[model samples]
Target: MKKKELIMIGLMIFSLFFGAGNLIFPPIIGKEAGTNMPITMIFFAVTAIIFPVLGIIAVAKSNGLKNLAGRVDSVFAIVFTVATYLAIGPALAMPRAGTVPFEIAIAPYLPEGSSVKTALFIYTTIFFGVVYWLSLNPNKLLDRISKITSPVFLILIFMLFLGTFIKPMGNYAQPSEIYSKNLGLQGFLDGYLTLDALAALNYGLVVVFVIKSKNIIEEGKITKTVITTGIFAGMMLFIVYMMLAHVGASSASMFPHTKNGAEILANTVRYSYGDFGGILLASIFTIACLNIGVGLTTSLSQYFNLLIKKVPYKIWATIWVIWSYILANMGLNKIMEYSVPVLLAIYPASLVLIMLALLDKWIKGNTIIYKAAVYPTVAVSIISTLDKIGISVPLLTVLAKKLPLHNADLGWISVTVVSFIVSFCIVHFSEENK
Candidate 1:
């Protein structure tokens, strides 16, 4: 592939990773982080960009998540891969991509007395219609998005970022809540909450397939290109995140009571663009969400097609698009409220899997290491996620909260490290005796 092809691949990767839910994260970080915005951004970049880039590289190096995760065993590999797909598919992400933009941009601007549900029904019908059509044509997916959708989306974002400078919001206030306490770790956890890292692991396959379709059949070359593309994509995401966070940080004093990133962004856009700003913001939201819908539906179709050999890609696309449409209409705030804790149930393990996959190149696929890392992290994650939704598991939650970094929601970090060490020692001693 030439430079142009590499650039297109980078753009396509960005488009896939740039979902409405992800976009809504950074600004709130900026708001709460306040004076610590820079520190939060550094940690945010780690969770939001570095981890996801690592995921992409791990998948590329191993050729797929299946192979990367298979070191844990076949049952784990299949189950983990499928769960990752579903979490980012109709279960959470795909639906959010369809609904968040609508809630943030379109619904806010609707005329009074108009039926919101009816309007949503009409909007999603058209939205998923485009998604289904574009997803069905996987070969043209990169071109349609990179050349058309992504550029428009980027331009709109650039305008918003630039506008913030031309007419600034006021200074950031004092840091709030956890951000006031531990900026870096708080931002890191917040970034993890975005779930983009998991998305990147799955997205690598889409980019690899796109490159293969371009006649780059050599595995080494393909993996190298994917890694480079992943870096470029990460850089792009960082830039976008920084810009959004800057907007949020600045608007903090101006809009202190604003609840979340979406509200922060909506306020900034309106302030910058005046009366017509909402329209421009709506355009940005639609383009951003539409790109995700297209990329996700296409990628999910590709994945399910390979997994379930009997089902045609078109049939899978049809099924998912319809399901996502139904979920999307359920209301974005509700979908978001539900998505986080459910994802938390899986995220710690998912991150552990990505870490193990990266280390597997050295560990040489040690199941002991995999088991050590996975088991405690998963147990902690379950207890933590349960606590998050007000479902207390009594002794477990109490014990978990006492673990170091538990207040930051990273008690599992210590668990991951200690378990790996203990497991390594046990395996080494047993093997030496043998």
Candidate 2:
């Protein structure tokens, strides 16, 4: 590809990675982090920026999403890829695509006694139905709409940030309960829960599909091009995330103490631009969310169309919209809570695959080593996730409860350590056997 074409591709990839959830988290972290916004932003950037960039690079380096996970094992490749896509699509991304519109746009307008349940049901159905319809035929409209929305989203956010800078909110209050100590770490972890990095992994597949369809790079060179493009895309993501976090921190005093991240973001936008600002922000979020839904649905439909052979694209898209609409009606807060354990179960396994894929040249696609690394990793991740949701794993729970960390999310830390140890042992034993 020409240099100019590559740059445009990189920008498009970057825009694809940024979504409505990405817009919501920073401000929530900022509000709670209060006096420690800087620390929090740094920590948040680790998962929000660095991990996601690494995921994209992993996909690129491995030549495609299938190759990235397939290196682990054929069964694992299928299971992991399918699970991740579903988690990011119907279970998380699609429903969220609908929810953000309501939380940011519709929620504030409702009367005290009015039925939020009814409104959510209607809005989500229409929002995802439109997504289903548009995604059924993937074309230039997808790109054009996203191109328009991404900039508008960025501009609305910039205006909100400008308001915060020009006329600051009240002085930062003391850090909230969790953020009071080690504000940076707490804020960073909180930001990680926004799951943008996970989204990037799924979105990178779409970017790769686009690149291939355009025939911009030869088959052999796709891997190198994807990595290079991903770096540029990742840098853009980092810049956008940092800016949003800063904006959120700056506007902390303007919002009430709300537990919901979406609520905090909506309130901040309303404070910055008043009713007009609210409408503008809502429009931006709605467009951004819709694009995300379409992209996710299209990606999944394509994958299944390939995998199942008999499933038509339109059939898969329709099924996704109906299922996602049902999931969306459960409400955002509940959906998020339900997703945590699933994320915990999947994230470590995904991370391990990403790490191994990036280092594949060194590892030489060793199946024994991959199995050794993955099995224990999955076992520990399952235990850790169960621990997180207050479900006891008996032996694992007993051991985890004694750990010296907040709520034992440190379980992930343990899982990583154990995965390495197991992989090393397997490699050593296998070499001796050979």
Q: Which candidate tops TM-score? A: 1
Provide TM-scores for the models: 0.94, 0.87
Off by over 4 Å in 2: 111-118, 139-142, 171-180, 217-220, 254-260, 330-337, 402-408, 425-434
Backbone clashes for every candidate come to 0, 0
Per-residue lDDT of candidate 2, residues 1-434 (tens digit): 77755666676666666678777777677777777777777787777777777777677666556777776668887888888888888887788888877876888788899898898888787788778777777655335544565567667767766777666677766678888767766755775676766666676666667677667567557766777777777777667766666666665666656665676666666776777766777776787787788778877887788789797978998888888888888766777777767877887676677777766775778876677677766776777677667788878767755644527354555655665667767787888899
Question: Which lDDT tens digits does candidate 1 get at residues 63-89?
Answer: 887877787778978887888888788
RMSD of 1: 2.1
| Candidate 2 RMSD to the real structure | 3.1
Off by over 4 Å in 1: 331-338, 390-395, 428-434
Name every residue pair that clashes in candidate 1.
none
